[model samples]
Target: MAIYFYGCVTMDGYLADSQHRIDWLHQVGSVEDTGYDDFYKKMNVTIMGKRTFEEIQNLPDVEKFYQATENYVFTHEKELKVKNYQAVEENVLDFISKIDKDKNVFVIGGNSLIAPLLDADLFDHLIIQIAPVILGKGIPLFTQSEFQRFYHLDQVRQFGQFAELVFSRKAPLDLPIS
Candidate 1:
């Protein structure tokens, strides 16, 4: 019941800069101490893409996520509206398998929707919150899928000094089929 993949990366991995500006996370310091408002109060569902939901719809009190959560917008563009919008634009893995798998989805990103959900492995965890500053290039936080994925690093919370890393997705070994 956890299909996570939160964000923030930049030690050299890049998550935005060469025009995909994030403004350095509000010039670094106090994203509510990086708990992100307690991870949006333990999210109930949030998936983005369509340029990170139009960069959170050009934030400036975008009604603060319409109070609490529930927003999926993958987009292929077709009058993409937003009230508390929902327009996946057809079969993104069957619109993420019809959501509501007991809630707690969250895939938030813009690498073309995390490159087809990490090549259909369908994610599990990848909290990530490095952010130190180093954009030798930009808009890259995993998206060239050739499939060699294997994570399993669990937690590592550091805060203010940054370092959140938390991965998990290493299963599928009994080699002999291809």
Candidate 2:
């Protein structure tokens, strides 16, 4: 199974402003202007944090938006208000490992959830769409981590004012047997 991270970030590499607001994203462009629909079609399952799920809840017809995929929200809450999404309280790694091998999992948001998978070298792909505007201070897409991982740039595309970059995890080098 392949795990993907597909989202838009500010030019400064932030997911949202300091207030946990993504109002700036709306100012740049619309989903129709981006390649979101094309990417969404390939996913069989989606995983996100509570904050991301909450943000989706605010949008109209939240049920129909993610109707195609099996949704999982990483939250401590015993149950979620949404009908389609299932609440997950276990360790992220354990939960991810249990997903069917044939499923293509898309990570909606949450740097906290992304970082751990990245550190463990489990994230297979990263598709970041960079918006032209920069927020001086905001919630970043990445945080300090103890381990370092590498990826190779596979493709780059432009959708209006946004630049989309596609990266894939680099395969580990093979050592010759003595």
Error of 2 at 91 (Å): 1.2
Against the true structure, what is every candidate's RMSD? 15.0, 2.7
TM-score of 2: 0.94
* Model 2 misplacement above 4 A: 174-178
Among residues 3 or more apart in sequence or in different chains, the pairs in candidate 1 whose N, CA or C atoms overlap within 3 Å are: none
Q: Which residue segments of model 1 deviate by more than 4 Å?
A: 1-6, 9-24, 27-48, 56-73, 79-88, 94-121, 124-127, 130-151, 154-160, 172-178
**Which structure among the candidates has the greatest lDDT?**
2
Q: Return the TM-score for candidate 1, rounded to 2 decimals.
A: 0.31
Estimate, for each residue in 1-178, the C-alpha lDDT of model 1 and write its tens digit. 6688888878898788878877886677657667767766777878777877777786776656746677778787765656775767775667778877777777777777777888888888888898788878888888756967777887789789678888877777733356
- Residue-wise C-alpha lDDT for candidate 2, range 1-178, written one tens digit per residue: 9999999999999998987778899999999989999899999999999888887887888888788899999999999887899999998899999999999999999988888888778889999999998899998998738765678899999999999999998876732334
